[model samples]
Target: MNILEIKNLSLAFSVGGRYYEALHNVNLSLKQGEMLAIVGESGCGKTITAMSVLKLLSPNAQITSGNILYKGENILEYSETKMRKIRGKEIALIPQDPLTSLNPLYTIGSQIEEVIKEHQEIEGKQARIIAKEVLDEVQIADSEKRLNSYPHELSGGMRQRVIIAMAIACKSNIIICDEATTALDVTVQAQITELLKEIQRTRNTAFIFISHDFGLVHKTADKTAVMYAGRVIEYANTKELFKNPKHPYTKALINALPDFNSKKLEAIEGQPPSIKEEFNGCSFEPRCTFRKDICKVKVPPCIKSENSDVLCWLYN
Candidate 1:
């Protein structure tokens, strides 16, 4: 069963007096305990899509169409009061920088306990115990002592662990990791990924991991969505997408990754189109190596195949 889903989600941002669409017909589904990774170049609408789930978008952003459903309920229709109930407790976000997410002035224990108090209605000693338990669950060492430490005192990895702890403290079923490991060292990134996998195994938690690292996505994601110029050009099982990428953009991205033995790197020729730009057809046409005359003027419909769903004229 799908725990969360974004169906035909279209969004636009108003700038100076014009509304430019930023996401186009985006469709994705996440099952319980599953990890769905959304990958793309910067400004491909990855973060915008994730933020839409929490309704934490900019004031000028508008949902032009479609629904964001959580557990079969269309959360797009939820009132702010009800949405507050959903955030943190039902769905939590682990942002890119833990330092920015944490309150420097508050002790780690106070921050964690505050979330517990607000969401779980637990107080005082019990809230503190739950906070400590969550910290221990995220594998923070010396959980007891760590509680009294402030955000500034913790290492980058430990601070991230604390952020994750807050999510666990609130018993969030779905955690959106928005480039959550981007600032960490490679070894710490590995540790955080492993910790996330462990949490999934033990708690049956679902995750939406957004990142630009194909190698990391290959290792961690169960399913991967490749976005290009505001659209999901390809989506499939991670193994299949890696082995046989369906969309030209997806293939180019994989080919562009650096090889260990060979010094050669394959880089895509052009930049992604801006939201301000208008496209009558495929947004990737300008840089696609396999572009056809039809691709120049006709938008490619999402063609569903045995192993993948791709928006490309080649699939036709």
Candidate 2:
């Protein structure tokens, strides 16, 4: 089943008396036990898209148009009370920073127990038992001992594990991971990714993994979406997208990857445009190497391929 569906979603934030769109016509879907990665440079609307799905956008931000459906219901129509139930119970989010997400005053066990107690009918002792099991599942050494330890007492990796434990405590159907491993070392990042994959296998949890690291996405995601200037320029299966990127933006991203076989790395030129208003032309045209006159004058519809889709005049 499709756990989440986003169709033509756009988000804008009012800044200095003007509204700037952060995400434009973004469409994405997630199936059970599947992982999809949204990758782009900073301020490319990667995190904005995730935040919109969780309805945690900033006070100045608002959804202009489109629908965000979760479990076949339109979540955009949900009230604050209804959205609260969906936030941690049905749709869980593992934020990038563990220190910021965890409470310094609370022990790991207490934190996890609180989550379980909120949704499940389990009481104090039972919640603690469930918390320990989840902590052990994430491969935290000495789960019992670590449970009583506060977030500040644990190492970076252990703290991340605790965050993951709390996220999965309610067995949410969908997990939105926004740069979840950015603060960890490479080795620890790999371990966390592996743990997430294992959890997905065992529980059939769907994942929307957001990251700036293309290499990490290659290891974790089944499909990849390339975002540019608040819009998705290309999307495809991970292997297919890496092997053959049709859009100029997607091509540049792949070429920029540091490879052992290649000495020089090709970088994309120019900056993403400010979205104070919608642009009639392609947003990526300014930075795209293969941009033509048509690309500068008109927006291109997403052209379908056998294994992918690209929004570029070059494809037309």
Candidate 3:
């Protein structure tokens, strides 16, 4: 069963004198108990898509057109109360920054307990017990003592684990991890990924992981979506995306990753298009090595590939 579906979704924000489109006609689906990674550079709308899923966009941003369906229900139609009920119980978020997400005034245990009590009917003591159990589940040593520690007292990895515990407090069906491991070191990143994989396997929770590195996506994502200039240029199964990247942009990104034996690394040239104006042609055409006349003059429709869908004139 599919947990979420987004069709023809476009998002825009009004700033200064003009409207900037951040996401354009994105179409994707998430199956239950699977990990889907949306990969792109900093300004490529990956974060925008994640915010849309959580309904946490700023007041200046609006959904231009399309539907976001969670379990066959339109999430856009939900009232604030209904959405509040679903936020932590049905769908939870592990935001990009653990430090900011934690409450500075409260202890880690108190915060986690508060989340459980708010979403579930439990006493303070019971909630605390559950919090401790979950903290241990995430591999936090000295769970009982760690509960008393403040956000500033714990290390970065420990704080991140606490955040994860809170996210899974009520056993949410879906979890949105937006650059969840971007702040950690290499060893910590590996540990966190393994912990998340174990949790997903045990609880059957679907994950929407947003990241900029293709190598990390390969480690965690079952399916991959490549975003560029507020649009998805390619999407496919993880193995297929690595084996046969159809779009020129996708090819460049995959080739840019450094190989262990090779001393040289190929980098993609040119910056992403500015969000100041809407473009008629492909946004990636200028940087693409395989640019053609049609690519520069008009945008291409998403074409069906052998194993996935790609938006590029080369396939057309």
**Best lDDT goes to which candidate?**
1
Write candidate 3's Cα lDDT for 1-316 as tens digits: 6889988999988998668888899998999889999999889998888778779889999899988999998998989889999997788888778887898999999999999999999998899899999998999999999999999999888888998898788888888888888989989988998888888899888999888978888888899999999999999998889888888888888788774215466689989986775678999988989989998789899998669999998878
Model 1 Cα lDDT, one tens digit per residue, 19-135: 999999999999999999999999999999999999999999999999998999999999999999999889999999898888899999999999999997687999999998999
Q: What is the lDDT of candidate 3?
A: 0.88
TM-score of each: 0.98, 0.96, 0.97
lDDT of each: 0.93, 0.87, 0.88
| Count of clashes, each model | 0, 0, 0
Sort the predicted structures by lDDT, highest score first.
1, 3, 2
Better of 1 and 2 by TM-score: 1
Model 2 lowest lDDT segment of ten: 259-268
The whole-model C-alpha lDDT of candidate 2 against the native structure comes to 0.87
Candidate 2 stretches with Cα past 4 Å from truth are 260-263
Using TM-score as the measure, name the better of candidate 1 and candidate 3: 1
Better of 1 and 3 by lDDT: 1
Model 3 stretches with alpha carbons more than 4 Å out: 260-264
